[model samples]
Target: MAMKRNGKSPVSSDTDEKFMFFKDVSLGPHETQLRFRLIHFWEARNPVKKTIIGLEMLLIDEQGTVIQGFIPPGRIKKYLPDLKQGSVYRLNNFYGSKNKPMYRVADHIATVSFTWNSELSVLHEIPTCFDEDRFRFHSYEDFEANCDIKGDLYDVVGHMKLVNGHTLIERPTPDEVKIDTTRHIMVHVQSHDGPVMKLYLWDQAAADFCKKFNSYDNTPTLLLVTAVNTKRLGGTLALTSMSPSRIISTGSAQTRRLLIKQVSADVVTKPWYYIGCSGCHAKATKGATSLVCTNTKCEKINTAGVPQYRAKISVYDNSDQAVFVLLGDAGRVLTGRHASELVSSYFEANGSEGADHLVPVPEALISTIGQTHKFCVKVTQHNFSGDTRAITVTKILSLDTPSPTEASVGNDIAAMSEGATQSGDAVCEPHKGGGVTADEESKRACSSADPETAKRPRCEN
Candidate 1:
């Protein structure tokens, strides 16, 4: 028992003594990494009379260096710890620099994130495991039935115009303006199991088109997609993300139940987007199409042209049981702002709509992109010696509907920017006495030129 002096208890005001560890601590140094945990601390009054702080330390990998440090008042004890006295920890990091030592942390005990020298490459020596009772999948064919994914799907054989040669860069006369491309012909595919898959295509027109942009050597590229701003072309589409769709892939017998965790990170996703045109309209249906026209009817067939369309793929490992890392960009498509703008302009210019089809290309494509959901995916990374490394992917999965945009008849992506300006509950903007016309504003809106009665999807392509 301590005696009271001058109205206060005679306890020591030493924070270090009171914060002494009470349980055993452990620290393991792997590669250059040091993983440790603080069990507990206590303050004991020794027989000699003065206060002594007792810290139970385990100091893992006794030979490896352990980080010894101190904590100040209002900084040491703040919340519950994830680790207990006998708890174990495994951190894939390095022994930090003493010169640039770590700072004193308040709620560091319960923090889920840890700092490292740089982006560390995690070694996956063992295969991930899963219950195999969850997840689902849909091939390019099913994507076809639901989406406008074109190609000789059932033939098991098709071609993807990698690069187009006959791109009309020169200002077209009334002649050049008429012949241009605007539709995308996606070669449907089948979903299979494995650690790796190949998605390459071949096309004559695309290959010849690619040759024009080649250096003096006349060497053509198998996947050299360049973006150029043209009056009539399409924008590019990257696989911003790849989560397992409705279903997940598991071991042969357990395909029904989605293995959410393992496959989650295996998919791919990108934050920003780079647009580019895919292709041009074929012969036959040109003059009949009209969306934002002056006297209304302005349609004519343009020549054949296919713009550069990028590729994005996501792989999955249904063996693991977590999905936090699955939503991310798969670097499958090209990443140049020039390429992005080129693609965006294509969809903006050549793309038009008929009362039947309703939507136009390039610009219409942006609207389509806006309507689609955003997702994430992970890939298999290969780690080498501390000096170097490499990585490759094998499977792919599209996870659940993680994030989808809200769309309504009056409120669409085209109007999203305008919607934010008006009062939250305010009435719609009234056209200045007259309805919307071509010269009034740039590009066009979903409600542009008055809603011309709902109609069927015109078979323009």
Candidate 2:
């Protein structure tokens, strides 16, 4: 019943001239024109970094309802100029279909698509309600309350306090034909209010964050991260990025000045123990009388009752206190002994203890308590315990000159490092050559010198 200034209806006498609301777009052929303002626009890309087939658009209507639209790559160029983000447009002759629920961009059950013959016209008037941009941000209290809720995702922005080095993980596909190795990075951050949290990044996100921080300049202290997923582990709430997440900076000159002043303010204290596997240098766990390799891929065991170093120490600076575990290189720097040597010395001194019995803590390990050292730490939730948090040492820094007794230990460490380098092997940060190329059955036949072979004990059945 609506008519333009002219005598006839806008489209036709029989057709409706009133713009269709986003909520009204359903799964059917339609002659109705939809007028909406663009909220977001992006090009979809594949995992291999190829430009995919569709242009994604998030549109909002006057009623405040949001809808998603897709344009095929072939028809994208025709409507490129009018597709400017935040612009208002009236589109007609498009088809609406049910969207894939698994990767739905919006809450709507249906998505609109533009056909080759679709008509689009720019509108100058923008809706006032839809003009203000808003983000669904969660406070530290909200994260604590709903961290265990299924499928709950949040948005958070934090100032970067520390960035840890990269670590690689190899995951086997369902078919098990090849393993995909992914690089992961962790960043420690805090909000202006009071809460501190950790952000984990993978693949391109990890690489990008590291590249920015490691560059000679342009190290941003503040990062605004969106689309975060929460998880409860080892009694702490951990935040990770969802597939659609992004990081932006909100740093200022004042933050940079503060960062320089606090660089050496003695924030996190040193760790006491560095329990590592003699084989892959991954952290090991006590299993009854034996020390089991935590790396699922490594087959090493310590059934010989060799004393396993267990570093679980509480450290506190004036600002904060945290319990951190040192493993691999960080452990080595503190104890000044290789994990294998620690095991050997323990069994040598405790020859009276049966190989199948639980071994006591070695004397060398007990001496490291209360000693101070610089370390790069990452916040992680333990896999088995949801309510407990584990601070993992990623790297170590020597703050002062070594004593004569420490100098002797450093020589031994240097000799071991040299030998490990020649064999393309590393105890801590096992990326050098730790993983086995062969299958599980063939791996058992490998020699003792093989890094993977050390995961198992000689007395094991």
The candidate that achieves the highest TM-score relative to the unseen native structure: 2
Writing each residue's lDDT as its tens digit, candidate 1 over 168-201 gives: 1221111112122422212111132111112222
Deviation from native of the Cα of residue 49 in model 1, angstroms: 99
Summarize candidate 2's per-residue lDDT along 1-461 as a digit string, tens digits.
65433232323223435566667677755666777788767676775868676788777876777677888888888887777877878887777777765444466777889886789998785433454232455567877776766454555665555455211112111111111244665666664333457678655556555444444244355556655677775566778765555543335453444433442232222222234456654445679887775555667757222222335444443245465554444556777886558666667877887744433344566455334566544322241244324454545556653323445645654655533431111122223334431111111111122332122111100
On the 0 to 100 scale, the lDDT of residue 41 in model 1 is 26
Q: In candidate 1, which residue ranges exceed 4 Å CA deviation?
A: 1-154, 160-335, 338-343, 351-461
Q: TM-scores of all models? A: 0.14, 0.40
Error of 2 at 343 (Å): 54
Count of clashing residue pairs in every prediction: 88, 13
Off by over 4 Å in 2: 1-17, 48-51, 127-129, 138-154, 164-186, 190-197, 200-222, 228-244, 248-461
